[model samples]
Target: MWSGPPQPDEGLPTGLSAVSVPWKNLGPSKGHRESPGSLVENPASRKEAQGEEHSAAAPLDVSRLRSSSMEIREKGSEFLKEELYKAQKELKLKDEECERLCKVRAQLEQELEELTASLFQEAHKMVREANMKQAASEKQLKEAWGKIDMLQAEVTALKTLVITSTPASPNRELHPQLLSPTKAGPRKGHSRHKSTSSSLCPVVCPTAGHIPTPDKDGKELSALVRAAVEDNTLTIEPVASQTLPTVKVPTVECNNINTCALSGLARTCHHRIRLGDSESHYYISPSSRARITAVCNFFTYIRYIQQGLVRQDAEPMFWEIMRLRKGMSLAKLGFFPQEA
Candidate 1:
């Protein structure tokens, strides 16, 4: 019943294959075996073939996964680079801001330093001016104190004299005409003779009825009067002379004028002294008279100064005034008057 090849299971047992079965005759004829409907299969063998195909595909899948992992790593590297660039930019901005702030702070500090220096200079100038003014004021106060001390000494001397003088007498007041002095001039044989007790010694006579008897008080008064007149400390004229004899030298009161020529030892003789008879004994040489007159003139000048009659000026008269005053004071003490 079979054609070219025997049917593989034509007389096969129902439960088992023949014992002499050939491997080439294991299936039906080739034409039937190749048919989809007649193809023989077992469950276990199909599973085994599918497992082999899966095993062969696993290496390709693993290769594809590895390639995807490499791509992911590359993208992560790009992200990291971008982040690093942003950080660098922020750091640069921060550094720039810090530098700018430092510069601004330095400028402000410099300005403050300048302002402080200016203020200190101004303060120093003010202090110097104030010190100068204070020093000037102190100098003025010292000068005023010196003047006050000198005046006080003068006052004390006057008080001492007034307390020690004598009491009055009546006979000395009654014959006061004998003490009267006549006019002084040049005349031959002018027969009036007048002498003063005060002329014998420098004595300041008492007022009318104020003469004392010869006693301790009287002697003390005479001594004090002599001392005062010799020292030129007292300005009182004796009661014996009514008018003081005037010298011929022209004198001008020192007003506000500061400079004037003062003759030291020059002399000019009067006409009365130039024409003289042999018996005319009233004569004083011009040089001798000038020496006496210079003393008188210097004392008068100092009195005027003490009375505040003259105002000092900025001119060169201060040296002259000081010299003359010192000379006059020394002359009153019976010492030689120095050259002015």
Candidate 2:
């Protein structure tokens, strides 16, 4: 039995009364009533409710999805920026390293050039020093060779003198008398032979073929002859004048004596003079020739004295010739004549 339509709140909960309708009032009303079981449901109303719920949930889901998508995009952008920064930093570092390496290479090349230049300079200095030393040594060697040649010549001259000076027989008289104006008488044992030009002693006079006598006119000539003998200008021959006997002659054993040694010495000296003339570099000037001639004359005098052919009084004159020869030698050697 239905008492009119049940109130809306009769069986429903308080909050659901607005949306839910009473099942007893679903159909016919007044004298006819419908049972709760016979209530007809509306398909359109259910469909509308479900559609509204679906629409509300869809909006919230869409907002959440959009926020998530925004977060993902922001994260991706940040990561890309970080990666780009890292790449740029790395590129900058690599560029700096490349620049540093290039600078080092340039510096090394410069140092190498400097070292090479210094080495070349050192080598050049060494070569120059060596060349200078070699030149000095060569000059010394030439001087030594010249001295050796001079000594060898002296040795050869001595050897020839020894060979030529053979002792005469013991019985033969070493002193032979030549033609002289002062001879008093002939000896008993000696035979007097006619005087010939060949038997005459060779005399070097200022005037050829003119013999100086003790007469007043020939006094000057005599003085000149004496001076020539003292100065060692002439070779010693057998004394043909009584004046030579007045001078103290050196007495020596006549054996093993070379009378021609003085002549050979003079010849050698003359040969040296010729050599000096031929090789101009060896003798610088005419003074050098004069010097050589003086030496020859001095040696000739020495040879005569050694052979006991000169007077003992000629000792002083020998010293004078030696002094003159020394001066000439000094001149040739580039020293002062006075110093010599």
Candidate 3:
């Protein structure tokens, strides 16, 4: 009665399906025993078939899920790269700012070093100048002390001479150097404004009594007077004349000087002076003061004058101007006219 191929059953036997079942017995009428739809389909057999289909679809679902996870991983990696790039850029900018700050600090340090070095150099210069000034001041003080010591010695010598010397004449002429000395001959380059002006002018020294300008004879006379004013010796000695009347001078004592030849020689220091002829006649022994002082007497001066030492004619005038003559008394020595 059925014409089409028979319907498939909901379940099929193992190793046999509904399609294998002959729907029509076209080969032979005896081979057809049942139709495809007429086959028995149990509930257990249908469950087994459905379970197999579900198992077959499981692998496809897993494959699809794995592909979706791969896509998600790729997208996340791109976002991570962008975040890293932004962080690195911020770091680079911070590094540049740090480098700028370091450069500024180094420049400031260099400038500070230079300023400190300059300050130290200036302080060193000031210290050096201060030391130089201190040294110069010390040198000046030493020279002044030396001068003071020399003046002290001169006072002792003046006291010695004042004890025995005779009074000077009231009619004594003026000192040659007191009233403006002779003008020196002009030098070849006189207009050059040289420092020799001190040499030309008279150097009136109040302390050393009378220090005249440098003349032909003033140099030697100054040296002699300086020795007397120095209180060191009696350079110009009077002659001892036996033919003329003898004036006895008592043996002298110098408490100021007690060393060397002047030590025990006070007894032998007595001498009979020839009045009015008080020229240098004999040489006396020098004391322990100056070595050349003994030989630098009037005799030596006369010899030097003969050998072209010019006129020191102001010697007597210099002696007169000095106040040493005030204490001198010729009447004390029993000379020509005795004083009242």
Candidate 4:
């Protein structure tokens, strides 16, 4: 009902209005500049006046303000620097991980390429044939070899003969039975067997009891006498056991190495890689042939336990064996990768 004019906003002291005015007037409206001496009576009075004026207005918090502002600035700068350093470190770690992954990917790709190539298989074959006929090709090969060895031995023996011995005519045969088999019966438990292989047989002279004092031409005595085997086949046998030189041999026992099973193991692993064995094809690639030698030489770092003959040849293969040990699922060939 008393809405004559709109009142100012409330929530103030009852007697005070929202819009206020300073009622106390110091002088007339005409402005004038005062002398410095009149404005400040003395240093103490001026300071007291300034202090009272400051107190009358509002309290200003100056203590520790500049120091706190400086501290805050320093803390903010330090935090920014720490954040920047952390970001840089994280970026570096990410880069390193990416590089490692790239290298691994390259290696994997190479292995995949190799695995996709052609497959290979290791082959083995064995055959046995005892009887040999003069009409067969194998017989011709044996005959030629036997003749060569016999001729060489005869030449060597002839070199030792004195010039005083009787000479034979060119038409006469120096050894009549050189091409014929011995007619004497074989001794018990000592039989001969002719091999169908093209390998050469060693030459053996007759026993001391059958040696003649002088040479004979086309004589009735047999030059060589050997027993027959159970199969009625003839084979030349040396008086003593000896190792013959062989070509393209899979392995050789030498330098105090009694067995070369290590070589067999390496070959088997190579074959497995050539085949489609996934683990072998990927990990045991062809290039590993040369790499394994270097790696195996460093195997002195570990102590090894062995079961059979220990050989220098096995040093490299033993390390490979330890890595590719036999599992329950599968095993390598009996002659090769199993434990060569």
Candidate 3 residue spans exceeding 4 A from truth = 1-40, 154-340
Report the backbone clash tally of model 4.
Answer: 0
Expressed as tens digits, the lDDT of each residue in 255-331 for candidate 4 is: 11111112311121221111111111111222232233223222211212231122246677666556544321122
Which candidate do you rate higher for lDDT, 3 or 4? 3
Candidate 2: which stretches are off by over 4 Å?
1-48, 59-63, 154-340
Per-candidate count of clashing residue pairs (backbone under 3 Å): 1, 0, 6, 0
lDDT per model vs. reference: 0.42, 0.43, 0.41, 0.33
Prediction 3 global C-alpha lDDT: 0.41
Error of 2 at 291 (Å): 23
Report the error of model 2 at residue 280, Å: 37
Best by lDDT: 2
Ranking by lDDT: 2, 1, 3, 4
lDDT comparing candidate 1 with the true structure = 0.42
Model 4 ranges with Cα > 4 A deviation? 1-63, 119-340
RMSD (Cα, Å) for all candidates, in order, is 17.7, 16.5, 22.7, 33.6
Extract clashing residue pairs from model 3.
154-230, 157-231, 166-328, 166-329, 167-328, 167-329
lDDT of 1 by residue, 246-296 (tens): 211112211111110111111222211111111111112233333334554
lDDT string for model 2 (4-92, tens) is: 42234354334332333234335476988775555444445545554555455556656777898899999999999999999999999
- lDDT (Cα, tens digit) per residue for candidate 3, span 1-340: 4345444445543333332223333342586776555445433554565456545655766676788889999889988999999999999999999999999999999999999999999999999999999999997887676566545534533433333344221110222221121222334322312443343334322222443332325345446445543433443332222221111112321221111122222222112111122232112123322232322233233333443333356775455334233322322232332112
What's the C-alpha lDDT at position 154 in model 3? 43
Q: Can you give the lDDT of residue 157 in candidate 3?
A: 34
Worst 10 residues of 3 by lDDT: 252-261
